[model samples]
Target: MTDAVDRAPAHVAASAVLRVGGRELDLARRFAVMAIVNRTPDSFYDRGRTDALDAAVRAGAAAFEAGADLVDVGGVKFAPGPPVPVDEEIERVVPVVRELAPLGPVSVDTFHPEVAVAAIDAGASVVNDTTGIHDPRMADVVADSDAAIVVAHSLAAPRTQLPLPHYDDVVGEVAAFLRERVALAEEHGIPRERIVVDPGHDLNKNTLQTLELTRRLDELGDLGLPLLVALSNKDFVGESLGRDRDDRVAGSLAAAVYCALHGARIVRVHNVRESVDALRMVEAILGWRQPVRLRHNLRPEGNG
Candidate 1:
C-alpha cells in the first residue's frame, strides 16, 4: 500500500514556501504557527489579558520562545461593539508590532488601510485582512510594501451585525471569494508569492456553515496559494463541543491537526505551545519533520 504521506496534497509539498517579512516560511517542511497577540481589551478569548502594551509584548515574546513561527498583532476586536478610529487602531497595534518584529515575523490583523500601513511601517510583515480587502486601499498599501497579505473571506464589514448569514455552498462560495480577492490583490501589485488565503471561520458564518467549510477546506487549495487558517477557539468549536472559549484547547488542536493533514499551511492560534506541539506531531508522523529524540526503541539493552 502507498504511504499516506505520499498521498499528501500538492500544496503541502516540500518546495512550497511562503514569503513574508524578508523570510521564507517552509510551509511543507515545517508547518508554520502564527501565535495570537491580541492588543484588544474586549477580545473574546483572552478578555483583556494582553490589552496592556507590556502584557502584549510579554505574551508575544513568550509565544516566540515557545516555538511560534510568527506573532499576529491585532488592536480591535473582530466582533461588533464600538467603532475604533483609524488613529486609535494604529496606536493600539503599531507599538506591539515594533516590539515583536525583532522576535519573529509580525502579522498585523486589520482590514483598515491606514492600520495596515502603520503596522507595516512599524515592522509588521504580513497584513491579515479579515474583511478580504473590502476597502481596496488595503491592497494598495500592502502592494507598496515588502509585506505579505492574508486575503480572508468574510461576508460583512468588521463591527457590523449580519444576522442569519447565508451561503448557498459555504466551501464553494468561500473558495470563489478568496480566488477573486487574490486576483484583485495581484492586480493591485501584490505578487502571488506574497499572498495567503483564509476561509474566515465564524466571521459572519454560523456554526453549521463554519463546520461545512472546515470539512471541505481542501478544495480551497485548488486556488494554488498558501492557505492560512484561523481556527483557534473559534465559535464553531465552542458550539460544536459545548465548551467555552477557555475550554476549547483540545477541540482546537484536533481541528488544527486535521487541517494540517489536509494541506493547511499556516494556523493562527491563541494557544501557541499546544498548537505547535500538535502540528509538529502531525508533521513528524507524515515524515515532514524529524523526531527530536528517537531512542525509544533503539536501545540495544531492550526494555527495562
Candidate 2:
C-alpha cells in the first residue's frame, strides 16, 4: 500500500476566502465553529431538545452568543428512523434559518435538493450535505443560489446503517471521494470558493478508521479546499474512551485540536464554548491568532 503522504497530492495553501450568504470568511486567519442545532426529535445527540421551532431558534442564538462562527440547523436525524417528508423537513428548518440568519452564517444540514432550496430561500448560506451529493439535483440547487455547500464523504444514504465498514485506506478513499464531489459541484456552476469538504467522522466509519483519518487528516488538504470536520461527541470518540455522549467533551476537544493542527478550518461541535476556546488556543499556538489582553506575565522593568 502506498504511504498516506505519498498518495496525497502536493500541498496547497488552504482556501483563504469562503463566501456564504454575501458574507466572506477569511479561513487562513481564523477557525470557524459550526454549532449544531438539530430540529429532529430523534437526533442522536440532542434527542428532541430543540425540535420545536422556538427552542431551535433560542439554541441558535445561544450558540452564537457562546462564540460560534456558524450554526447548522438540521431537520432530520442522520440515523435511520422515520422518514421525513420534504415539506416537513422544510417546515422544520426554514423557520429556524430565517430567525438565525441575522445572527451569523447559517447552514442547513440536508441531502434533499428541495429542502436545500427552501432553506437557502429562508436565509441559509450553506447546505451541509451528509450524503456527499446523493441527490443529483442538490448541486444544481446550490449552484443556482448564493449559498455555499459542504460535501461530506458518506458511502450510504442518510439514516441508513452501515453494519460494517471496510476500507482499503480510509483517509485516501475519503479524500478521493470528496475531490470527485467537489468537481461535481464545480461542474454544476458552484465555484470553488463556495464549496467545503468533510470526511464525515463516524458517519459510516468505525472507531479505528476514524482515528486513522484524524491522524492523517492533513492529506485531505491536498484537495486545495478548506476542510470542515465534525468531531462533536461522535461515536468514534465515545467508543475509544469508553464514555457516553455527555462525557466525551475532553476527548472531543482533543480530537478537534488534532484536526485543527492538521488542516481543518471549520469544526462542527455540540459544545460551542469549549470548542471555541480549544480552537483559539490551537490558533494562538500556531501563531494564527493572538492572546487576549495579555498582562499577567509582564514583569516591571524596575523590579527586574
Candidate 3:
C-alpha cells in the first residue's frame, strides 16, 4: 500500500484562490494576515482587552485598517476554565461577527456547532475550529453554509488541560492528523478548496514540538490544502526567546516568516501591521508579490 504522502500528487497546482463570503483571496499571489479579536475576558493574550462588544467591534475594525486580510472573532478562551454556555458564546461572538462582516471577510473561532451556525448566519465566512473538529457536527454546519473551515490538529478537546502531549514524530503526526480531519471535512461536503489545515502549534504540544512543526511545515503542503498557522505570541516563540507575551512580537514575526517561506498561506496574528509587512516582504522575496515602489535606491539615469 502506498503511503498517504507518496500517493499525494508530486506537484500541487499554484495560484490558488479562495472565496470567502464576498471576498476573493489569492492564496498564491499573497499571504493572508488573520487578526485575532477575542471577546473573552480570560483570553491568553489580551486578557479581556476587547471583551466588551463595542471594544471587540473596534478591535476588528482596527485590525482590518491595519491590513488584516481577515479577522478571527473568538468568544471563548482556549485554555481550561469555567464552561461558557453555547448561548453565551453565540451572544459574545455573533454581534461582533455581524458588525465586522461588512468590513471584510470574517472568521469565527469556535468549536461549538451551534456557535458556528449562529456566526455563519450573522455573516462569518469561515469557521476556525481549534479542536480539530472534535465536534463533528461543526463540519455539518460548515458544509451547509458557504464558509470555509480551518481544521486545526489538537490532541485534546477545547478548554481542556492535558499532561504534556507526546508525539513520536511531531511533523508526521501533525500531517497525518490534518489529513484525517481534512478528509472528515470533505466527507461532510466541504470542498477541498474551502478547507484549510493548521498544525496547532502549542495547542497540545510543547515548545520543542511546536518548533519541529514549524521546521517541517512544508510536509503539510502535501495535503493539497492551504495552510493556516496560528503562531501569534504563542508560548513556543516566547519560550524560545525567553520573552514574555508582550515581547514576543519579534519572535512571532520570525516564526511567521519561516512558516511563510515553508508554504504557510495564512498566518493568524495579533500585530496586524507588522505581520503584514513581514509576510509581504517574504512574498516579495519569493516572487509571489511585488514591492510597492521600486525607486528607493535606483538613481535616475545621468544623475549618479
Candidate 4:
C-alpha cells in the first residue's frame, strides 16, 4: 500500500473539509491547525485572556493571522471543578466569540447545550463540545444548522472527583464513545458531513495514555470523520520536558506536528506559527519525491 507521498501529483487527503459558515478550513492532507484562544481566567493555558476581552480578541486575531484556520474560543476549563452555570458560561465566552467569529472560522469550545446554541446564534460557525454529546440537549441545539459538531470523548465531567480512572483500552473506548455520539447527533437531525471526532487528550488521560493515543492514532481514524487533535501544553508535556506551562511552546509544536504527519486532520494548538512551521517541514520531508543530497556528493549531472 502506497502512502500519500507515493501517490503524489495531488493526492486527495483522507480528511474532508466542511464549511462551517463564511470561512472554509483546509482539512486536506495533514489537518490544519485550530489554534486555541482561551477566554478564561482559570484555563490551564492563556488564563489572562479571559480577564480582558480585548486581549482575547487580539489573541484570536493573532491565531488566525499566524496560520490557524480556525480559532477555538472557549471560556471554561475542562479541569476538575464545579459545573458552570449557563448564564455565567455565556457571559464568559459570548463577547470573544462575537469579536473573533468575523475574522475567520470561529468554533466555540464548550460542552453546555445552551452555550453551543448561543455561540452559534452569535457568530460561531462550529460548536466544539468536549462532552461527546453527553448532554441531552446538545445534539438538538445545532440540529438544523450547517454548523459542525465535534464529538470529543471525555471520560467524565470536568468536576467529577473520581479516582484516577483506568481504561483497559483507551483508544478503543474513546472511538466507541465518539462513534456512539456521532450516531446520537445523526439521530437529532445533524448531517454526517458535519461531524468531527476528538479523543479528549487531557480530560481524563495521564501522560502514558496521551502518548499511547498519539502512537495509536489509526485506531480512531476508523470513525470516518475529520480528526481534530489538540496537543497544546497539558500536564503530560510538562512532566516530559520538566517545564512549566509557559515553557511548553516547543513541546506543543512538536506533538502537533507529529500528530498531523501521522494522519490527524485538525490539530488544535496554541502556538500557531510554530506548529505550522513544524508541519511544513514534516510535509516537505514525507512529501518529497527524493531525499536531499549532501554537498559532498557533488558529482555533476553529466559526470554521474
- Top candidate (lDDT): 2
> What's the CA RMSD for each of the models?
2.3, 4.9, 5.2, 4.4
Q: Model 1's lDDT to the true fold?
A: 0.89
Better by lDDT, candidate 3 or 2: 2
lDDT of 4 by residue, 7-77 (tens): 53232334466667655555664447788888777887776654578888888898888877888888877
lDDT of each: 0.89, 0.89, 0.88, 0.77
| Model 1: residues with Cα > 4 Å off, grouped in runs | 1-5, 13-15, 300-304
For model 2, residues 7-116, the per-residue Cα lDDT tens digits are 32332345678989799988875789999999988888988999999999999999999999999999988877768899999999999999999999999999999999
Q: Rank candidates, lDDT, best first.
A: 2, 1, 3, 4
What clash count does candidate 2 reach? 0
Q: Compared with the true structure, what per-residue lDDT tens digits does model 1 show for residues 254-281?
A: 9998888677889999999999999888
User: Lowest lDDT 10-mer window, candidate 1?
Assistant: 7-16
**Which parts of model 2 have CA positions greater than 4 angstroms off?**
1-14, 299-304
Candidate 3 is scored at a TM of 0.93
Candidate 2 is scored at a TM of 0.93
Best candidate, TM-score-wise?
1
Clashes by residue pair, model 4: 31-265
Each candidate structure's TM-score, on Cα atoms with residue i matched to residue i, is: 0.95, 0.93, 0.93, 0.87
Worst 10 residues of 4 by lDDT: 7-16
